[model samples]
Target: MSRDTAGTAPASASAARTGTARTGTAWRRMRLWGLAHAVDDLYQGLVPAVVPYFVLDRGYGYVAASGLTLAATLGSSVPQPFIGLAVDRFALTRLAPAGVALAGLGLGLSGLVHPYPAVWLLVLLSGLGVAMFHPAAGKAAREAAGDSTAAMSVFAAGGSVGFFLAPVLATPVLVAWGVGATALFLPPALLMAFVLVRAGRRRAALAGAARPRTGTDRWAPFAVLTAVSVVRSVVFSGLSTFVELYWLRHLHASQLVGGTALACFLGGGVAGTLGGGRLADRFGLVRTVQLGTALTVPALLALRLTPGQLPPLLFALLAGAALNVPFAVLVKLGQDYLPTRPGTAAGVTLGLAVSVGGLVAPVFGLIAEHHGPQGVLSVLWAVPLLGVALGCFLVEPGPADQREPARTMDPAGRSR
Candidate 1:
C-alpha cells in the first residue's frame, strides 16, 4: 500500500510540473508572437504614412512614388508563397525568427538610405522580410492554438492590435522626426527576434512529441474560399489606404476626425477578430464567415450613401466588424483544407490574399483619380458582392478528410 501511494504521488507531482512548464512556455510564446506582429505593424504603417511624404518632399515624381510603393508591396508579397512552402517542408521553428530579424534589418536600413533608388531597393528588401515572417509566424500561431478556433482568434487579434497601434505610433514619429526616426523600430525588432529564437528552440525540442494527423484534398471548396478571401482583401486594402483621405476630402471632416474614423475601423477590426474567433468556435467557421460576409455588403453600401458623421461612423463600425471576421475564419479554413500544411494555408490566406489586394490597389487608385475619392467607395461594393458569391460555394471539410493533400504542398520550396 505504501509503494502504491508513493508511485501515485510521484506521477501526480510530475504531471503538475509538466503543466506548469507548458503554461510558462505558452505565455512566453504568446508574448513573442505579439512582439513579432507589432514589428510588422510598425513598418507597414510607417511606410504608407512616410513614404509618400518622403517622395513628394524629396522631389520625386508621382509616378516614381507609386513605383516605390508598388515595389515594396511586390517585394513583400511575391516571396510569401515560397516562404509558406518552405515552412511546411523544412519546419518553421528556426526560420521564423530569422525572417523577423531580416525584416528588422531591412526596415532599419531603409531609414539610413537617402537616394530614391536606394530607398526603393531597401523597401524591396524589407518586403522580403515581411513575406518571410508572416507564414512562419502564422503557422506557429495555429500550432500554439492547437487548432482551436477560439485560441486562433486570440492569436489573430494580436496582428489586428498591432495594425491599430502602428499608425498611432508611427504617424506622430514620422510627422515630428521624419522618416529617419524609423531607426527607433530596430530595438524592438531585435528584442522580438531574441524571444522568437528562444521559442523556436522550445518548439524544436517538442517537434517529435506528436505527429499531426493526415488531411484530405478538397479543391473545389478551397478555390471558392480563396476567391472570397481575395474579395475581402480588396475592400480591406481600399479602406486601409484611403479611408482617412476619403473622410477629410468628401465629408469635410477635419484631419483629426479622419484619423479618428480610421482608428475606429481598425479598432472594430480588433474586436471583430476576437469576437469572430469565438463565434467560429461556437457556431462553425462556415457560419461565422457567411454571416460576416453577408453583413459586409450592406455596411459598405451604407458607407457610400451616408453623408453625416453618425451614419458613416455606424457604417464604418459595421463594415469593420464584417470585414475583419473573415480573416481569422479564412486562416482557419486554409488550415482545415490543408491540415497537413497549416503553414501553406496561412500563406495562401494571409500572404496571398494581401498580395491580391496590393495588386488591386492600382486599379482602385485609377478609379479614385477618375471618379473622385467618394467614387472609390463605390468600387468597394463589388468586393462583398463577390465575397458573397464565392462564399456560397465554400464547403466545410470532414474530420477524417481535413485537407486536400495535392494543394497542400507547394511545388516550389518556398513558404508563403
Candidate 2:
C-alpha cells in the first residue's frame, strides 16, 4: 500500500508539472500574439501619417487627399464583420500573416504607382490587407489570453504603442529619405508574417495535443458591444482627424502647439489602455466602461470651454485618457459575453465596431466644415452621452462581471 501510494503521488506531480508548463507556454503565446498585433498596428499607423505627405507632394488637393484617407479607412473598416464571420468558419492563424504580407506588398506597390486614381486604388488594396490583420490578430489575442483582463490590456496596449510610434518613426523617414524609404518597413512586415506563421503552427500543435472542448454561441452579446464600440469609435474619429486642426483654427494655437496637444491625447490613450484593463478586472466591466464614458463628458466640455493653452492641454490629456481606456475593456467585455467564441467576439468588438467610426467620420467633417471645428467637438459631445445611456442597458456578466456573454443568435439561427 505504501509503494502504491508513492507511485500515485509521482503521477499526480507529473500531471501538475505538465499543467504548469502548458500554462507558461500559453502565457508566452499570448505575449507573442500581442506583439504581432502591435507590429501590424505600427504598419497601419505609418500609412496615414506618411500617405498624406505623399498626396500633397504629388499635387493632390485637400479634397482628393481626404478622399484617399477615407478610402484607406473604408478599406480597413468595411470588411471587418465579414472577416469576423470568416474567422469563425476558417482557420484564422493562416489568414492573418497572409493579410499582413499582402498589406506590405500593397504599400510597396503603392510607391511604384503615381496617378491619383491608381494611388487611391492601391490605398484601398492596402486597406484590404490591413482589414485582414485586425480580425485574425484580435482573434488570436483573445484565444491566447483566455479570460484574463490583464492579458487583453497588454494586447490592446500593443496597438496603442504602435499608433504612438508610427507618427514619430515614420515622419523622420519620410522627411529624410522621402516616400521610397517607407518601403523599408516591408522586410519587418515579412518577418512578422514569419513569426505569426510559426506561432500558429505551435498553437495548432498544442490544440491537437490537448483536444480542448470546442465552444459555440459567441455572437449575440457582440452585437450590443458593437453598438457600444461604434459610439467610442465616433469619438476617436473626431479626435484623431480633427483635434489638431480644431485647436489651431478655433483657439489660435500654433501648429506646434496643436501637434503637442494631439500627442498629449495619444499619450493619455496609451496610459488608459493599460490602466482601463486593470480597472475592468477589479471593478467589473460595466463599471469600468461607465467610469471611462462618464469622464468623457467633462473632458469634452473642458475642451469646448477652455481658453488658454494649459487648460486645453490638460483637457486633451484627460480626454485622451477617457477615450482610450474603454477600448481594451470593451474587447474583454465582448469576450466575456461570448466566453466560448473569443475570436468572434474580438472580431466584432475590435474590428467591426471600431470601423464604424470611419464610416461616420464624414458626418463629423461636415459638422466641422459648417460650424467650425468647435462644432465638431460639440457633435462629438453627444457620443459619450449615448454611450452612458447604452451603459445603463448593459447587463453585467456572472461573478466578477468581467465576461460579456453572447445574448443573441447568428444569421444561421445558432444561439450564441
Local accuracy of candidate 2 as per-residue lDDT tens digits, 1-416: 69999899999999999767754544454566667667777665655555545643576544454566576678878887788778766666678888777676766566566787887787777667778887777766665565667667878887777666665666566657666666777776688889878766656644423222244444555566677788888787667666766666788876456656666776688888888987887788878888898888889888878887657888888898998888899987876666656656677677667766766666765676578668888767778888887777776655534434333211112222
Q: Give the runs in model 2 whose Cα sits over 4 Å from its true position.
A: 1-29, 51-63, 107-113, 174-181, 210-220, 247-257, 308-311, 399-416
**Mind giving the per-residue lDDT tens digits that candidate 1 earns over 74-120?**
87778888888888887657666676676667776777778877887
RMSD of each: 8.1, 8.7
Query: What are the models' TM-scores?
Result: 0.83, 0.80
Best by TM-score: 1
Can you list the residue pairs that collide in candidate 2?
A: 217-416, 220-408, 221-406, 221-407, 336-403, 336-404, 336-405, 337-404, 337-405, 337-406
Model 2 Cα shift for residue 202 (angstroms): 2.9
Sequence-dependent TM-score of model 1: 0.83
